[model samples]
Target chain A: MSATLAVAAAQAKTKTSNYARIYWPFVVPAGLLVFAIIIAPWVFTLIMSVHEWKVGEDPAFVGLENYIRLFNDSRFQWAILRTVYFTTLAVLFPMVLGIAAAVCFHKNFPFRGLARTIFILPMMATPVAVALVWTMMFHPQLGVLNYLLTSIGLPASEWSYNAVSVIPTLVLVETWQWTPLVMLIVLGGLASLPQDPYEAAKLDGASSWQMFRHITLPLVWPHIIVALVIRTIDALKAFDTIFVISNGGPGTASETLNIFLYQTAFAYYNMGYASAITVVFFILIMLVSLVLFSARQKTTFQ
Target chain B: MKMRGLPGKIGFALSVFALISPAILVFLWMLSLAFKNEVDNTAFPPVFIPNPPTLDNFRAVFEKNNFFHYAWNSIIVSFTATGLALLLGVPAGFGIAKSKASKAAALIMIARVTPGLSYLIPLFLIFQWLGLTGTLTPIIITHLVITVPIVVWVMIGFFEGLPAELEEAALVDGATIWQAFRFVALPLARPGVTVAMILSFIFSWNNFIFGVVLAGRTTRTLPVAVYNVLTFEQISWGPLAAAALLVTAPVLLLTLLMQKEIVAGLTAGGVKGG
Candidate 1:
């Protein structure tokens, strides 16, 4: 055993040395591409954020003025508020619906595969197309949504047009498009869960809800947190659906940080100010992600 | 609350359908819109199905704009990006898997998480400086920001799932490292390759922001075409929905066909990220 272990150790050393030469070649191409394409530009964004730059003018260094200006920019402030509101609300429905659906599909049931296949389609379809479809459905007079509402003995209001109801309306669309993704993530966890604990709980005469609430939910907490992190990030980054549907419409009522940043950079030609927003955006994402990660770690080890 | 036997089965199926029907109903509505005429499209008591369904809306979208041209640009950009991503990503995945290269993996994941707008700003200026704006080249290159990481990350999952003994056995049989990867690992990863290829293609095809920032009038992709139809032309629901469907139909079909693999691919990233 000792001799074999020594041979294995020697083999590992040689293999690692070979890797030192070979691995760099294999990794460098992809590394260089990502660095050149993503990382380098990100660094440039940081640099550009500090400079007073605009189109057709030479850039002059402006220190922390742009960053400081962001605090006083009301539109940017509203954009941040709208973004938080959108992400928080958008993530809730999908988690609840997705978990319920996952629970439904977790056990053996008739036509479960077919049901899941149908359920997953919405998340798979193109976002742009999904946006347009929902936009047409949200139409006030000729929309199917209003038709369905009135058929149910409920009054119909302007869907995306009403500033008061716009975020909820958009959240409905978001939930429609993304609940399947959450279901997909959670279903993966459900499929792999051990049956032993479930059987033990059943032996104790635990009710189904009790079994789920105690055994299943604890085991699935990590997976749920993963879904939460991904959903939060995607929700924060949401652009295509909003861009196509409202274009941040109804008088900046729905304009999120992404829209504000885009307009500041491209429309208003305030590159420096936009870059400052980008930096803050990055910081916000990192902080939220760190919190989520630490939470996931706690749940996973427990 | 447990309904045993037949009633329970029925209830489960009913609940599933209730949860899923919104997506189905909306799709049916989209199809109805795409097949209706302008009069019936805007008609109150909105036509659930077009009476005497017309192909004129599809024809109008195709004729009024160069739909095929935009589709061509989409095909070119996605094909180049996905193909390049695969070529670069597979070996990178293998190397990272074997080396336990966590930093490399994290580096690639940055491209995945960084907002496209951040890259859009500087790359737009850089492409302009290089005089490469208004062409397909920049669009294809920028799409790498989406494709390469997807390919690398997905492929890493596949390669890592593979047992090390297979490669060791090949090496024992007098195969070189290159031959072992080529003969043993590559063949085993064919399914992973297929998933990565399809996903990268579909995502690149679906991308709108890059094309919006980079493409000239004649160089736009299909999603942009859908947007232009909404903005530049009249809001004829029939033609608008038709363009939207045409843009998504290919990917939607592929997703339906490969639901299981796609789910696995998507969740693998999430699990690994966790």
Candidate 2:
């Protein structure tokens, strides 16, 4: 027994030493890249927010000026309100539509797989491609959507060009592109459901609606939260679709914080101000994510 | 029973059709628009079926736009990024998983959650300083941000699920640790590798924000190229639709061909059983 134990200890010591050498080579580079790429940029944005500079000029330290300006600026406030509105509309519509679709196809039906695939097609397509297609379909005079509306006796509206319609139009396009993501989450949750409760409900002579209300809704709530949090984060950071479709529009009507930052940093060449906006945007995202995460934790605890 | 059965069947059919109709209609409309000429594209009523469909727009897209170049660029960037990501991420994932490094994993998640543009600008400045702004290197490296985490996260789940007994047995047979991983672990993880490849490729192909801000005219990607077409030309619905369709065609075909794999890739690490 002593001999066997000594041999095992030697093997264990060798294994531990081997693992130490093999592990650091993989961990260190990945760790450094993530830090430089993600975490450092965030810190840089925060630091740059307090400084003032144009593209070529040296950054002049102006403590609290940018934040002060941000608070007093009317356009910035308007952008915040508009972004909140856009995020709300964009997130809610997709959530409701995706849940509806998931519920519809939750059970085994003929061509169910095909139907699910088709629904997910939009999500898989490149966002730029989707935006370009919608841009054509939103043309004022000859676009298919306008023609359909006019044919149905509604007044034809300038979808993308008109200031009144651009934000909502962009929201609709976003919802159309993202609803499939929500459906996928919900479908995963639905599929993982235990069947005993469902079978019990059926034996109790409960209708489909009752079963859905009592069992499905409660069970899928976590999935719904997951979908909402993901969509909210994505929607809050929306840029590519809006950039392609409207370029933030005829006015600043469709401009979110991201668009604001892009235009300020690149187009206007005001890096300091753009950095300020980015810092604020980051904080906003973190706060929203934290709230959602805490709420989820509470529910899980219950 | 018969009366209820008929109603239930009809209700199920109607609901399923309703859920699916929007997507199918949009796809069909895109297809019809791709083949239609200008006159047919804007006829009095929107034609579901274009009378006498033509290939002129497709020809125009190919001939005028150098679309084949853009396609090649996309393939190169996506494949190279995916290849590099797998090389780096798989071993990283295995190390992290074995080490139980949740903090390191959370750091990766932080990278994933932060907005792309926030980091993109600073990186743009850095690339400008390095004089590598226009080349494919910047874009490919930038894309690693998207692809690596995906590969790493998926691979973590895969490696964790794997039995350690195989590697132990290989080690017991006098194999080196690297040999145990290379010979025993990698071959068994082929499905996860496939998932990583398909996903990383799809993401790198679809990504537009980095390409737009970083890429110059010579190195423009398909998504950026398509956006330029929208902004540059007169809004000719026919040619624009044709361009959109042409840009989407390769990816659409890929998704269709690898539908099951793509689905598996997206759902990886999301569900427990999956």
Candidate 3:
């Protein structure tokens, strides 16, 4: 009986090893690529951040100096504030519009499918191309947007060209592109909801707004949170559209942390400073993710 | 369900139309600007239609730049990156799914969450040192940073949804794990593969930041080329809109052709940033 028990243990070990041999071979290649391509560069960025390095100069170790300067820099402070400001507007507008759109489309209507397809087109088009076309449309004189505003008895205003309105204008473009993404996600959530509660609510003669608020919204809250998290991350790292439309123009009014980092690294060739900024930017993203995900967990339990 | 009157139905339709018309009009506006000549493009009333739409803008776009060359570059970069991503991600996804390795999946998510610039700055210096900048290789490799995670994440969900019985049957029938995967699992995963391939291709093709930094003048992709047009050509609305349209045309065509698959791919990873 003891020998039999020993044999059983040996067989279990071999079986596990065999499984490992099969699966590890499959996983290792991708793991290596992830490490080499994604992981290594981040490690390098972290290492570079501690030094006082520039393009065409020798790197000198200056632990925390770049970060020290970063916190004190007014421009960096404003960039952080602008990033938060832009991200809040970008995420909020889309969530509101997307939830509204998803709810509207959830009810049966003529050409609903066609409308969804049309709505997602902006999300599909390349950001650079979209930005260029929007820049054209946002033209103060000859652009269609101002023309429409004027024809509607509203005064034409500088869209992205003005300093004060630059971030909001950029957020408008961001909202236009991303609302469909949020809509689609929320639509998926809505489609999966059980019908019993909604049926009971209808039997109770609840108003549509009440039903949506109490039933649909709670049921779809997880999906909304997911969309919120995705949009926040995307908006935080928004580079292509802003780079094309304003490129942090009107004297850097639209320059978020991303644009500032890009200018520091590429335009100014301040690699060390940029690396420090990258570290901060990454931490900010992670922090937001943690907060949003905790909210997601709470929603899941309720 | 309560029956609606004709007035109610019409109102519903009109509201839906109002909701979607902005999306339609933006694309239509881009289209109008693309086909019109400079005169009509910048007209005071903002011409919604061209009385005599001409191909001159398209012709000028082609003439002013090496548009075909850039298009070819985009094709090469996008396809190779996506193909390589499939090669790496699909099997890894299968392995992780089969093993229930939640940790590995989380690692891939981390890669997706990290900003592109974080990887890009260091890679830029290294590529320059390795004398690999200005080549398609670095762009293709960096694009894997985008494409691989997408493929892996999508495939993990897909493989998890797949039943394990068939693979187990293959294994019991004197087949090795690889054989079971190749014959039973991969064949069953065609739809997932298609979705992953298309999404990865579209994303890689549409990427601007990678090409803007890594691609040289001769190796510029279409997005980067369109950007160059913006910077160099003084923003000629006719030609500029035409160029923008040209860059977006392939993606728009792909989206139209594969809308269902694209939507599935998107909502499949409903939690991730597209």
Q: Please give, for residues B1-274, the per-residue lDDT of candidate 3 as tens digits.
A: 3326889777777777877787788888888998998888878988889779988989988887788999999999999999999999999999998888899998998876777878889999999999998789999999999899989988998898899999989898999999988999999999999999988998888899888878898889999999985557656888888888888988889888888888888876752322
Model 3: per-residue Cα lDDT at residue A56: 88
Candidate 1 runs further than 4 Å off: A1-12, A15-21, A299-302, B1-3, B271-274
TM-score (chain A only) for the predictions, listed in order: 0.92, 0.90, 0.94
List the pairs of residues colliding in candidate 2. none
Q: Sort by lDDT, best first: what order?
A: 3, 1, 2
lDDT of 2 by residue, A1-302 (tens): 99999999998987787655566667776677677666777777788888897867888999989888987988788789888999999999999999988877677777777777888788777888778878778888767888889888999989989889999999888888888878888887887889899889888998878878888888888888888887888888888889988888779888888888888888987777878888888889989988998898788522
lDDT of 1 by residue, B161-216 (tens): 99999998998899987788889999999999988888888788888888876888
The true-structure Cα RMSD of candidate 1 reads: 2.9
Q: How many residue-pair clashes does candidate 1 contain?
A: 0
CAPRI band for model 1: medium
lDDT of 3 by residue, A1-302 (tens): 99999999998987887655568788889999999998899899999999999988998999999999999999999999999999999999999989988887778766666678888888888889989989998999998999999999999989999998889999999999989889889988998999899789888998777877788888888888988888888888988999999999899899999889989998898999999999999999999999999989875623
Q: State the TM-score, rounded to 2 decimals, of chain A in model 1.
A: 0.92
Return the top candidate by lDDT: 3
Error of 3 at B26 (Å): 1.3
Q: What is the lDDT of residue A234 in candidate 2?
A: 84
Model 1 chain A lowest lDDT segment of ten: A18-27
Docking class of 2: medium
CAPRI-style class, candidate 3:
medium
- Share of native interface contacts recovered by each model: 0.66, 0.48, 0.68
RMSD of each: 2.9, 3.3, 1.8
